[model samples]
Target chain A: MNLILAPVRGLGRATLAVVSAVGRGAMLSVDAGRSLRRVDQWGPHLVPQMISIGVASIPLALFIAAFTGIVLAIQASYTFVGTVPLYFVGALVGKTMILELGPALTGLALSGRVGASNASEIATMRVTEQIDALESLAYDPIAYLVVPRVIAGTLMFPVVIALAIAMGIVAGWLTSIALLDLATPQFVRGLRLFFDTYDVQFAMFKSATFGTTVTSVGAFFGYTCTGGARGVGRATTRTVVVSSMIILVLDAFWAATLL
Target chain B: MSIELKDVHKAFGEKRVLRGFTLSVERGETVSVIGGSGQGKSTLLKHVNGLLKPDAGEVWVDGQRIDQLEGEPLYETRRKVGYVFQFAALFDSMTIAENVAMGLRRIPGLSEADIADRVRTALARVDLEGVDEQYPSELSGGMRKRAGLARAIALEPAYLLYDEPTTGLDPVTLSMVDELILRMSDRLGVTSVVITHDMESAYRISDRIVMLHEGRARVAGTPDEIRDSADPVVRAFVEGRADLLEEAS
Candidate 1:
């Protein structure tokens, strides 16, 4: 009876923590929305953040997309050889990159890079009393800090996703020509044959949503951080985990609802 | 402007920090709050600027009820009251000049030239000279404290709140900080509220010293009155005798 009761209590505590976090996150979103109205104040800060989030993230996203596209092309060729035309590999790679892999994988990578950094930086500010200092100075910390990062992330995610898709398609095309013994004309034909403008639009939408989730989650955890150094570390870890999970869940939701 | 806290009650979780605590400070007065660690000294200072609102009671700043205020009204009040944190709390990413200029830029119609001039003047007032481009991390502890003071004073606030300003400083630096506090109060005509455990510094700088214990302002008087207080708790604290408190308890 004691063991059963202890597990139940633990479960209840876990549920409560999760619910509290979600509620807090909703409140933060509303606050951020209101703060966004005064863009003139925070708008200048957004460019630097965008450069940090979008430009700095490009190398890693491209690197991952390159390898992912190459692997997908190779695997598709292996699976479709003799059973179907090899040109199908191009269609497969292109479709997957635009419709799913481009946004999802880039979002996951950035969840670790940008999300973790945002959380740690903001958490450090909180622990060091910089946030309170800002408040004491009559500066709205949400407007000064959180809103800029959120706007940058929302704007840059689609750009990063687009770059990743381009890199992935190019890498996949090169891999097909080098290893799969496929003619460039046939591969290009396959890509053009199945192309739909809606897939690109869908990917753009998903990237923007994922970007918002990754940044806002990090900002929320960091802004509300307590305890000190250990708490900052926890917030960073939670930002990565929660952002990645949310990106994947969002990926599924978009695919199911839109596709 | 003057400050007042009436029957203020504050608690974090089950631990009550301030219990029906009340105090008042006249404009242009320097009051030092001294207490043992975690005795709500900092919490009380925060209440003056509406940084930390009380769970129950009213906080009046210059006859305005500030505890109930929010948004621009609250920020307007905060803009007039400058808070100096224990560790200076400067933005590490920015230079000392940028940090000092931050609050000045918030003033409407202040041009770039005006902000720069105020930053220089504020830095000079704190005896910090020509280290504008250096970051907070590059400055010594004393310099950082001075820079933090400069940042707070650049706005030319009506009230200044100091939270343990002399805690980590050496004896010389501590005296220097105390002197700076006195000079700022006199020159700027800003009301000052200092929270510290340094009894000697408190006695030297404050017009009145408030001693907090057991979640209340147990002793409130001039330095001489506090020194001669008959209350055991006040006696134990002023004399720095933990044994007396233990024995009394």
Candidate 2:
């Protein structure tokens, strides 16, 4: 018991120091007055970051969302057989697509793509003392570096998710018509029946939270990294793994409670 | 305004970096701290800017308790202190003019035109007036160091702390940096504290010298006093002992 307590006490002290350092960094960030300046500097860099996160993920988002929707429709059709009309298939798939799968999977994919990239980039900057240089120049690392990226994540992720859902629905609709021979009118009617305003609201809510969580966690870890190159890499990997896990877990919790 | 450290103590785990260290520098005094690496020269400078706190004792800046200052006041205190690192430490993302203009933009009521003028003047002071549009990576070692100096002095701080200002420069560039330090001190009336292993640059630029050893000020005196001191550590340092010289050739 004493031996365990000894290590616990040491860990507690280390945690306090880390907390203090972050608090100091946050305070200094407010004083730096260069958040706008950082955004300007980061503006050019974000093009590539955005391209990787938003543009590159497009094909994958479409592929996954569409297949999932079609598979769900086929499975529902198989189970219902003659009990429900074949037309109800689109509604079942569309509802699940927008309300559950679209936002959740898109968030998951982005957690791997955008969130990890943010962590590695910022962690590299932190390890290399570039963040320290900003602090020394009286630029707030949080306000200048972290805040803008956080805002960008909060704003940008939803747009990407929206794109994911739209593309997903289009692909699923085409698949049903081409492969299953479901009438277009039947498909549209089924989609309208299953997808409601409430589901859309809930879906958006989950995605926004997912986006904010991934970004905040990624930025926090990256900014507080210690050691050098190896440490930064470890932080980056940890961010991707941890954030992906948390997003899925949080999605489950939200779904259960909201439903 | 003066800066003073009284019985300061700092440690990282079991590795004690500062132990009962004490020193003082009066207004406009250009004191150079000369010591081997890991002797806590940079640590001592950090204490002045409130970047680090003493584990035991006090740091007084212009008669104000540095560790006690908090929030906006501490930031305001920091604004009056300028620091230059060994590598020039210019923000690579910013151009030369933007780097120099960094601190100046924070001052309220300064028009854009006035900020630009001040930036140019600061650059001129460092003899880096024309290359305002170039990035730090584009500049020569001497120019990068000077550009950092321009940024450091931009806010017209009352105190300047330079960490090995001549570390990686060639002999000609080293002297140029030395001359610039001397000229800035004389021209701006900024109290300067320089940390360096370069004994020649130390002698050329400092009015007084403090030699740190084992985390304490082993000796503090004028450059001549340092040269003439009978302290064995001082002698070894002045003679450029191979072990003490480290990487500073």
Candidate 3:
């Protein structure tokens, strides 16, 4: 009976902890929303963040997408065997890259790259008393630090994902021609066979949401972290893991609801 | 125009701090709060600036209950107080000049020219004249502290709060920081509340020294009074004697 109660209590505690975290995250987002009204204060930090969080993330995003496209095209061929039309490789690669892999993979990649950095940077400031300094100096930490990153991530994520998706398709096209017997025209035909503008819209929308989740999750954990360097390391790790999990969840949600 | 905290209580999880703490620094007065590592010295200072709200009491500044203030009103109240953190806490990325200008830039009508001028003047006041282009990382610990002071003064806050401003400094630099604090109060006519573990600096710069023990002001008086205090805790801290702490406890 004690063992049973212990496990039950553990489960309840974990549930409460998760719920508490969600509530905290929501409050942070609400605070960021309020900071929006003081645009003059937070606005100056936005462009630099876009450059840092978005523009700097491109090579990594495109690199992951390109490799994914190659593996995807090859996998489609291997899975379907010779029984299916070879052009289906193009369809598989195009659809999967545009609709699923592109944003999801890029978001995952950035969850590690952008998300971890964001958490560590802010967490370092937290431990160093810079956040307190910001507060005492009459600057809103949420507005001056967190909001710009969130806005940058949300606005530039789609742009980065869009580029990655295109890169993936091109890589897949090249892979089909060189590796598989499928010609350019055949691959193009397959790509065009089922291309829907709605697919692009869905990917963009999903990527935008992923952006917000990644940055906000990173910022939230950073703000809440304590201890010292060890705390910063924990926040960085949490940012990556939580952002990746949320990205996958959002991916599934978008696919189920939109498609 | 005084900064006051009345019966303030604060705690983190299981560790209760600042229970029933009370103190007030009149306008233009310089008070130094000294204590052991976790005796709520910093916590008490944070209350005065509205950085940490008290759980059971009130913090007042300029006739406003600052602990109850939020948003723009809180910001408005905070703008009048300048806090120099323990670690300097300068923005890591910005140059010293930009850091000094940060709070000034937030003001509505300050032109770029005026902001730049204030930055220059603030830096000069702190004796950090030629390191404007350098980052906080590039500066020595003492310089970074001065830069932090410069940043605080750039806003021309009526009240200045210093948290361990002379910590981790050599004797020369410590004396320099002590002098800087005195100069800020004299030059700007700003009331100051400084938290420090250093007894000498406190004795030199503070008109009054308050010893915080177990989350409350255990001893409050002039430096000479604090030195000659009959309280064992105060004697332990003022005389730097760990043996006297046994008697205190």
Candidate 4:
């Protein structure tokens, strides 16, 4: 009896897409280095794209973290009340926020804003043959296109995560102090004393990794998208979804290894 | 001193675009390939610069087999061949000066002033002086095409390829482009292979016209010879008869 190959075919296509996207992004990165020699041509444009993707990401990150911190504190308080003593609340919240939730959530938020935007922008450039123009001039499109994005993401993600962590901690602190009636100084001390210095290093490490993943995946998907505007839309959607999923998986793996 | 293709064959899965297609362009000769769309005209140009490789066969630039060159050698091979797209295909985000400076950046041992002088000269050659600071979006269609041409020739390539150089221009602009092609080819002594279905442009600019059919050279001759040929296919195409087009289709 012959089994239908539909599922296998679908898997193959998805795998092909992921591999192709990664390969294309890396190729562009190499090309970008070559194109960087013409930095005078690309410099002004690169400034704006980097600023738009990096600087504008700040407020949106804070907004997400504020709500997220509120929700997490409420959930943890509800789950751990009576089962554990009240003093453990700060420790639990601090560990989760600093270690996993802060960087991971920041990257997930970025996946929607910056990832989708990068993908659609690059895909449009591709469809319009702007990318081809770079090649014709012997300018590497990757170095000209993707490297700025990777650099922006690498430099920007940590800043956004740091902002998110600050905002979330404040929000969590406010909720615990006002709504849950936990002592302020005790909560602060619990968070301060929770872990060794290695945890901060580990958290920054996770943020950097997530930044690389977001930029690479987004660029790969964007540059390889075929057809036209509709294709760009599909690429943007897929980039965000794939980037978010990867963020979660990587976050889990890092937590397991680092902890 | 010329670009030559020896038995170039390229296939996409089961469909073949070019099958054993061979052609040559002598130094300082302007050759035009006139073919229906999807006849591998654009693909032929791409192969010369190593953008796309042939499935089987070889392409030689000067005396070098470009198909076998890779890395720095392949890029060096590309530095000597310039291709202009049907659309201007200017890098939209870059200023005109930056676009023109693209190829000049990689020139080894050239001083900054020398590179700047070259960029200025190349832009001036395309009649785009004083527009270096402008972006491509600020230019009109004719100007953009000229800008594209400036970028193409900025490297001072020994060979140039034009892919549908006159497809989207008005009669006036088209004539202007045709004039630019002739003037540039004459001035630089660059071997030119232009692919176009525009008969008038083909006749005006080409030293010889080649009619490509079914992925091979169907007929190649001087413009007068092509126009006055006794071959039925050539006669039908030159005359633009509906029945002939239908039959060819």
Better of 3 and 4 by lDDT: 3
lDDT tens string, model 2, A34-122? 45455544564455555655677677777777777767767767866779887787887777777778988888877777777778877
Docking class of 1: high
The interface RMSD values of the models, given in order, are 0.7, 2.0, 0.8, 1.7
Candidates, ranked, DockQ? 1, 3, 4, 2
Q: Count of backbone clashes for each model?
A: 0, 2, 0, 6
In model 4, the clashing pairs are: A28-A142, A31-A143, A32-A142, A32-A143, A32-A144, A33-A143
- Deviation from native of the Cα of residue B243 in model 4, angstroms: 1.6
- TM-score-wise, the better of 2 and 4 is 4
DockQ values, each candidate: 0.84, 0.32, 0.83, 0.42
In the range B63-164, model 3's lDDT, one tens digit per residue, is 899999999999998889999988899999889998888888767799999999999998887778999999999999989998998999889888999999
Interface RMSD of 2: 2.0
lDDT of each: 0.91, 0.79, 0.90, 0.81
Q: Which is the winner by DockQ between candidate 1 and candidate 3?
A: 1
Candidate 4 structure quality by residue, lDDT tens digits, A90-135: 7767777778778988889898899888898888888877777666
DockQ of 4: 0.42
